[model samples]
Target: MGELVARSLIALLFVLNGAATARDPEPRRAKAAWFGNPPLLAVRANGAAMVVLGLLLVTGWQRTWVASGLGVLLVLTTIGGHAFWRAADRAERGRELTQLVKNTAVLGGLLLLAMP
Candidate 1:
């Protein structure tokens, strides 16, 4: 029951993320602001990797390794993109901080899913 709920939530998260990546223009701006405007190749690669990871999570394939990898990525992304930049305004900093916490929670969820 708990596992089912967790799996459902993770699936919903990934699906929503994929859909937003496909349809949202704001993400591009946010990515550029946070990630030093990485080259187009890098962006595409990240998106491709995200899609593959999302599929793995959704399908429950190699659950431990996939979730671990995703957790690591989320941590690294938060550190590299959000924590590294201390924004000038409280509002900006708060937004980034919230994202950091959110990513951490996602990491926790992935770790839980990886557990037996």
Candidate 2:
């Protein structure tokens, strides 16, 4: 049951964040302004994906595929949202770098979950 608990915890993380982002995407959109036009729409869509996919993962429905999709979303978010390379100062870079590392670890977990 450890695996189930772990999966639920991870999924919960995504679900809560996703719900918040879907409800208010302005901050994410602003952060990723350069990603595309209609940034708000994109942010909301990304958040919605996170919610749906995270639920699928928790429910063990197509676990591998759901995890893979979540991993992809995470990579996109890390690149656009964190972007440590674009930081203008030491403190900013450090903050972004921390986020990048945390996202990387989460992505690793997703990858393990994606394994058959």
Candidate 3:
């Protein structure tokens, strides 16, 4: 039951993320601080990677390896996108901090799913 719920959540996250990227003309620039200054190709690649990772998680294929990879990618993304910027203002910084926490939680959840 819990596994089912987790898979559903992960799938939902992927769908929403994919939709957001598809809808936005300049996704990289739109969330520049959060996503880093990725080249267009890199941004597209990352999006594609996320979709594949999400699918793997949902399908429970090589569960541990896939989840670990996703966790690593999320960690790197959080550090590169949010931590690196260190917004000047309190409000902006707070938002970034919140995003960091959210990303960390997602990573943790993925790790837990990967565990035996």
Candidate 4:
């Protein structure tokens, strides 16, 4: 029961975030401009993958594969979105660093879930 609840909560975060990204790639596009301005299609594709994998995770289907996929997706996202070192201002750097740490924890959780 606890595992199910944890999976559900985590899945919900990814699913909702993915849906939002898929629905509006423009914001992500602008934010990721430093990363060479990934195309809207690419952004949407990533989001779609997240949604599909997150759903699979919560459904207890192919848990290992889904968790691995999500972990990869999260790594990419953290690199592109939470590049704290790139922040020019102190406050901005702090904010980005916080995000990076949060994502790192989430990634750790996903990795644990991936194991048999």
Candidate 5:
């Protein structure tokens, strides 16, 4: 029951995130710069993929694979989007640190979803 709830909530989170990223990509574009700043189009594509994958996850198709892959993505973006060590503003640094920790927690939840 908790697993089902977690899966649903995580899917909803991805849905909202993907939609926001697709709609307002500037924020994501800025953070994604660390990895050579791929084209904005690529970022948009990633958001779209997330939406699709999130839908698949909600339906329980390949749950373990999807959860694991999403967990990996969460880890990567947690680093990419919130490397507090590189932040200039103290508040920004703290915010980023919080985001990183929150992402880590979500990643743990995803890992749980991956388990049988």
Candidate 6:
């Protein structure tokens, strides 16, 4: 079904992104530095949470609760990682803005999934 496919894709996104961050976290660390020097462990924690939440979402167990948790996670990551306004390079700024918008839209989809 289309819903399953959508959920699968979203879950894949979370898993892949999380894996990348967990493995090579310098990029994420740089982004966090834009606000302040956040600890590397925090980035690892995000990665771990994303993978777990994404897997739960794909399984469709307690769908509403999983979706709500993922939605909140996405929003927090967007605020922490995608502060486009703080980007000095124009191209980097543009990229961050795009990612911010994309994540925000995904947050909406997660909220929709959260509905009973």
Q: What TM-score would you give candidate 4 relative to the actual structure?
A: 0.94
- For residues 56-101, could you state the per-residue lDDT of candidate 2 as single tens digits? 9998889999999999999998888887888889999999999999
> Candidate 4 on 33-115: residue-level lDDT in tens?
79888999999998998999999889878888888899999899888887888998999999999988988888888998899
Q: Which is the winner by lDDT between candidate 1 and candidate 6?
A: 6
Q: Give the CA lDDT, 0 to 100, for residue 83 in model 5.
A: 86
Residue 74, model 2: lDDT of 93
Choose the strongest candidate by lDDT.
Answer: 2
Residue runs of model 1 more than 4 Å from their true location after superposition: 22-37
Off by over 4 Å in 6: none
* Residue pairs with backbone atoms closer than 3 Å in model 2 (clashes): none
Model 1 lDDT tens row, 36-98 = 756555544555556677777767788888777667656655775676256778888888888
TM-score of candidate 1 relative to the true fold: 0.74
For each candidate in the order shown, give its overall lDDT on alpha carbons.
0.67, 0.89, 0.71, 0.88, 0.80, 0.86
In angstroms, give how far residue 10 of model 2 lies from its true place. Answer: 1.2
Q: Give the Cα-based TM-score of candidate 5 against the true structure.
A: 0.90
**Residue ranges of candidate 4 with Cα displaced over 4 Å:** none
Instruction: Count the clashes in each prediction.
Output: 0, 0, 0, 0, 0, 0
Q: What is the lDDT of residue 31 in candidate 2?
A: 73
Deviation in angstroms for 38 in model 1? 2.8
Regions more than 4 Å wrong, model 5: none
Could you tell me which residue pairs clash in candidate 1? none
lDDT of model 5, residue 22: 77
